[model samples]
Target chain A: AQRVTQPEKLLSVFKGAPVELKCNYSYSGSPELFWYVQYSRQRLQLLLRHISRESIKGFTADLNKGETSFHLKKPFAQEEDSAMYYCAPPDSWGKLQFGAGTQVVVTP
Target chain B: EAGVTQSPTHLIKTRGQQATLRCSPISGHTSVYWYQQALGLGLQFLLWYDEGEERNRGNFPPRFSGRQFPNYSSELNVNALELEDSTLYLCASSLGVGSNQPQHFGDGTRLSIL
Candidate 1:
């Protein structure tokens, strides 16, 4: 069974500190990984994808197939970056499965 | 263009009652996917409809069903709702053209079962 695992339920970091949210996926085929974020009182939106290789909101994720991981990273966390981040399943024809999200709280 | 839209942002129902949630995909999107976002469950794909047909479905009971119309609008019906059925039901839409087009989401409908 294909699954995406977000090991951290809540990750706390001080403002201006670096943040990394870990994600691991189990899939046999070439996987297309994505990071989705939901800010408070807002709809869930796509942050970035492995294929695009573009960084959004100062966050970037690299797909490491050998390690079966696609970890989201931000060099400097901002207070506004506090939000719920969800990692999606491997690319498929239809909707992608999601892992239990990780909530990041940036404190002063 | 407007994003995916869901109706009745908040709903309250009792046990044994049925709940119907509606979703309108983006103007050109041909695929609609329904997901249940419950506490600690993340997001569970419920159903996927494309070209007015049920293409894929998650592991859910028969009581959970839905269909897509010619306009690509979709609805999810939860029958005999239980307390555990309380969740945020989200609807997302994708172009269904090329692969890897990320699904755009709407602010989900929050269903509260008592």
Candidate 2:
């Protein structure tokens, strides 16, 4: 079975500190990974995808095929970056399997 | 252009009653997906519809069924609803059935089953 795992339910970091939200997946095919974010009082939106190799809102994720991981990382966390992040793996048919999501809180 | 839209932002119903949720995909999107997001649980795929056909479905009971209309609008029907069915139902739309396009979501409908 294909599954995406987000280990942390909630992660807290001080402003200007580094932040890393872990994500791992189990799949047999050439997996396509994505990161989706939902800010408070806002709808869920796409953040970035591994295939595009692009970073959005100062956050970037690299697909580690050997480790089967696509962890989201940021060098300097900002207060505005606090939000719920979800790691998703879209199947060949475009059905997205999402992780439980990790809530990040950046303290000032 | 407007993004994906879902009707009935919030609903309250008793157990055993039926509930219907509607979704309207983006103007040109041919694929619509339904998901259930229970509190503290990840989003679970419910159904996938494309071009007025049921393309795929998740591990759900027969009572959880839905259909797509000719215009690509979709409806999810849950019969004999259970307390566990209370969840935030989300609808998403994509250009087609592939990874080339990202799925855009609408503000979900929060269903409360008593």
Candidate 3:
């Protein structure tokens, strides 16, 4: 079965420190992955997608098919970056298979 | 434009009772998806509807049922709710089937079953 795994449940970091949240998936097709974030008291929103290869809010994720991973990275964490991040890969029918989100806490 | 919207921010019910949650998709969106956000289960896809038809569903019991209307608004009815059913039910919307559009989520309805 196709599945997305976010190994970290919580990541603690100080302001200006680099942060990386790991995600691995098991799927059989040309994978298209996306990252979604939910900040405190806010609705969930799309952060970035692998296909676009674009950075948003200083975060970028690269799809490594060989490793079956699409890890989110931020060179310098910010206080506003503290939020819940989920790595999702759409299923064959386009339903997002979300991982067990990782909560990132960037303190000042 | 307004994003996806869900009704009744919070609901409290007892076991064996039924709970009905509503979701209104974004204007022009034709697909609505329901997910269960529990404490540890992350987000489990519950159902997907498009054009007033049930397109897909997750590994949930029959008690977890829902439908979509012509306007693309959706209703999720949880019958015979259990204690474990306490969760944040989230509703999301996207473009029609086959359209590669990201889903927009609502604030979610927090269902608490005693």
Candidate 4:
């Protein structure tokens, strides 16, 4: 079984402050990690994936096997960045396990 | 192309009643996935369908079942509904099964069991 954990239920940061949303997972095999974001009144969508190894909208997440973590990070936060963030395993295997999600509230 | 779509944006049912939800995958996509977002449970995989076949299912019971059609559309049926069964059922689609392609989600069908 695959499980994902997002320790924080709500995360708040002021404008221009660096932010990080923590995520951890447990899987026996090589894990496929992804970060999805849901903006206000918008459907959920991919923010950035570990395999892609690229930043999206100033957000990036690194998959660490040793620590079993894939924490999302942003150099500077903006008010528009407020949304729900989910860490998940691959949807292909039907596990698609997602963390409880972190509600990010970026304040100006 | 249009993103994934789900029918019956909202539904209401009573205990022991059954509910059916539908989904249409994106053009050129052949995979559809069902997930449930309860009040506190977060998002959970319910089932996966690809090419008109049941490729996989989550830890749900037999009461939660679904099938796929040749057009890549899908249906999810929940029987013996309980109050806890009320939730937002989301449908997602990708190119196919076992790929790295990100799943595109629908707005979701909100089911309320009384």
lDDT of 3 by residue, A1-108 (tens): 788999999999999999999999887364567899999889889998777665579898878888889899999999999999999887777777799999999999
Candidate 4 lDDT, A1-108, residue by residue in tens? 567889999999999999999998776354556788989878888788666664479898877889888899998999999999998765336335679999999999
Instruction: Give the worst 10-residue stretch by lDDT in candidate 2 chain B.
Output: B94-103
Candidate 3 segments whose C-alpha is farther than 4 A from its true place: A28-31
lDDT by residue (tens digit), candidate 4, B1-114: 898899899999999999999999899989898999876667888998888989888889899999998888999999999998888999999888654667889999999998
Give me the candidate number with maximum DockQ: 2
TM-score of chain B of 3: 0.97
User: TM-score, chain A, per candidate?
Assistant: 0.92, 0.92, 0.93, 0.89
Per-residue alpha-carbon lDDT of candidate 2 for residues A5-108, written as tens digits (9 for 90 to 100): 99999999999999999999887365567899989888889998877775589999978889889899999999999999999876655577789999999999
* Native interface contacts kept by each candidate, as a fraction: 0.60, 0.69, 0.55, 0.48
Q: Write down the lDDT of every candidate, Cα atoms only.
A: 0.88, 0.89, 0.90, 0.85
Residues forming the 10-long window of minimal summed lDDT in candidate 1 chain A: A88-97
Clashing pairs in 1: none
Higher-ranked by DockQ: 1 or 3:
3
DockQ for every model, please. Answer: 0.60, 0.70, 0.62, 0.54
Q: What shift in Å separates residue B33 of candidate 3 from its native position after superposition?
A: 0.7
C-alpha lDDT (0 to 100) for residue A64 of candidate 1: 86
Query: How does each model score on TM-score?
Result: 0.94, 0.95, 0.95, 0.92
Measured on C-alpha atoms, candidate 4 has an lDDT of: 0.85
Ranking by DockQ: 2, 3, 1, 4
Candidate 3 docks with a DockQ of 0.62
* Residue B89 in candidate 1, Cα distance off native in Å: 0.5
